[model samples]
Target chain A: GAGVSQSPRYKVAKRGQDVALRCDPISGHVSLFWYQQALGQGPEFLTYFQNEAQLDKSGLPSDRFFAERPEGSVSTLKIQRTQQEDSAVYLCASSLGDGSSTDTQYFGPGTRLTVL
Target chain B: DQQVKQNSPSLSVQEGRISILNCDYTNSMFDYFLWYKKYPAEGPTFLISISSIKDKNEDGRFTVFLNKSAKHLSLHIVPSQPGDSAVYFCAASRNQFYFGTGTSLTVIP
Candidate 1:
């Protein structure tokens, strides 16, 4: 089976520009998650979705970050105003069942966003 | 303040030696612990996980040990191979997830 996947493997955006990142979860996965990975650092959680409903978004860094999963399978992470600090790799993950800590998360290749 | 911390930035070991990566946490609420391996330009790949109830979990050459009292956990790889060289992340969870800075491991063949 195909694993989780993300689009725009690499992106360079001018400061203050808006950027939309896409994620394709594994077929039939019930849970989706977004994370940001800074250089030389591990990924930091951003938001989580169970189906089309976002269950937890406490990890979102700021108001500029918005995420959605209208169809439960595909998800998007949008940054309203890009900043040099927003430069990082955006990763997406999916799980088989409910969005629980016990469930194993499978990750995608990720989108490296560089805000200039 | 970061809840999870991997103090070591990098480590190197021979292919036949053991590689130990450590993680510490300040929160006692974390009930589940996980280890992930990542490569450059790629997302993290789940390696193994352990529940707070158990002290150890092993999968092939990889073993994870948890110490609730110390609020710490460690991952050990026996007879490390060149392919095993990658960045390892430590994650702890109760209802939400918290990740460490990650430790890069290099195995020389």
Candidate 2:
């Protein structure tokens, strides 16, 4: 089966520009999550979605960050007015069951974004 | 604050030897723990997981041991192969997931 996948493996944008990163979860996955990983650091939580409903957005760092999963399959993480601090690898993960502690997350290859 | 922490940044082990990676967490409420492995330029892949109820879980060459009292977990790999060389991340979840700084493992064949 195909695992979670993210598009635009690499992206370079100027500061104050807008960027969108896409993620395609597994066929039957009901839960999706986004994370940001800085250099030499572990991934930090960004946001979460269950089906088409956004469950948690508390992890989003700033108001410029936004995410949506309208059809319950594909998700997009959009950043308005990109900053150099946002230069990190954005990762997407999905699970077959609801976003619970027991469900193991399958991660995508991640999209590396660089803001200059 | 980092809820989950991997104190060691890197470790090297000889092939066919045992590789042990350790992790600690501040949250005792974490009910489930997982390990992930990653190569450069790739996202992490789930390796093994253990529930809070069980003290240990084993999968082939990989084994995860959890100590609830100590708020610690360890991953042990036996007969480590060169292919096992990668960064290992420890994650704990209550409702959301908290990941540890990864430990880079180098298996010399």
Candidate 3:
């Protein structure tokens, strides 16, 4: 079975430009999550989705960031007016069911976004 | 504020020796602790995990120990192999999971 996967292994964006990163969760996974990892740092949570409904988004940095999982399988994280600070690897993860303390999350390769 | 912290940025050990990675968290609400291993150009993979109720959990050569009193956890790898060299991340979860800065481990053969 294919694991979770993200598109555009690397993306270089100019400051103030908008960029969208996509993630494809594993088959039958019902819980999806997004995270940001800076150079030499750990991944920070961004948002979470259970099926088509977004359950938590408190991790999003600002209004410029938006995420959607409309069909409950594919998800997108869009950043508007990119800043140099936004440069990092965006990671996507999914679990077999609504992620609980018992479920383990499988991660994707991640899309590295570099804002110039 | 960083809730989870992995103080050691890097570590090196001789092959066949034990490697211990430590992590601490400030949030007392975190009940679940997880360890993830990552290699270059790849995403992190789940290694092992422990809940607050249990003090230890072991799988194969990997063992995770949790100390609720100290808000600390550690991952121990026995007879570390070259293939085990990679970045190890510690994560704590309450309602959501928080990750540490990560520790890079190198095994010298």
Candidate 4:
């Protein structure tokens, strides 16, 4: 079975531009998560979704960031007025069970966003 | 305020030797711990995990040990192979997950 997948393996954007990254979760996965990985650092949680409902979003850095999982399978993370600090790799993960810590998360290849 | 910390930025070990990676967390509420391995240009892959109730969990050549009192955890890989060289990340979770800075492991073949 195909694992979680993210679109645009690499994206270079100018500062102040808006960018949207997409994620496709595994088939039938009930839980989806988004993370941001800065250079040489671990991934930081961005937001989480259980089916079509967003359960947790406290990890989002600021108001410029917004995420949605409308159909419960596909998700999008949009960043408005990107800053140089926003340059990082955006990772997506999915799990079979509910959005619990006990469930193992399978990750995608990630989309690297570079803000100039 | 980094809750999870992996002090060692990098490590090198010979192939067929044991590799130990350590992690410490400040939050005691973290009950679930996980290890992830990542290769260049790829997302992290889940390795193993342990619950606070259990002190240790083993799968194949990989073992994860958790010390609830110290708020620390470690991942051990026996007979490390060249293919095992990558960045290892330790994560702690209560409701949401918090990850460490990650340690890069180099296996010399």
Order of the predicted models by TM-score, top scorer first: 3, 4, 2, 1
Q: Comparing 1 and 3 by TM-score, which wins?
A: 3
Candidate 2 docks at the CAPRI level of high
In angstroms, the error of model 2 at A36 is 0.6
Worst lDDT 10-window in candidate 1 chain B: B36-45
Q: Can you tell me which runs of candidate 2 are displaced by over 4 Å?
A: none
Q: After superposition, how far is residue A74 of candidate 1 from its true place, in Å?
A: 0.6
Q: Please, what is the whole-model Cα lDDT of each candidate in the order they appear? A: 0.94, 0.96, 0.96, 0.95
Give lDDT tens digits, candidate 4, residues A1-116: 68889999999999999999999999999999999999988999999999999999999999999999999999999999999999999999999999798999999999999999
lDDT of 2 by residue, A9-54 (tens): 9999999999999999998999999999998899999999999999
- Worst 10-residue stretch by lDDT in candidate 1 chain A? A37-46
Per-prediction TM-score: 0.98, 0.98, 0.99, 0.98
User: DockQ, in order, for the candidates?
Assistant: 0.84, 0.87, 0.85, 0.88
Pairs clashing within candidate 3: none
Question: Lowest summed lDDT over 10 consecutive residues: which window, candidate 4 chain B?
Answer: B66-75
Model 4, span B1-109: residue lDDT tens = 9999999999999999999999999998888999999999888999999988999999999999998888889999998999999999999999988999999999999
Candidate 3 has a TM-score of: 0.99
Docking class of 3: high
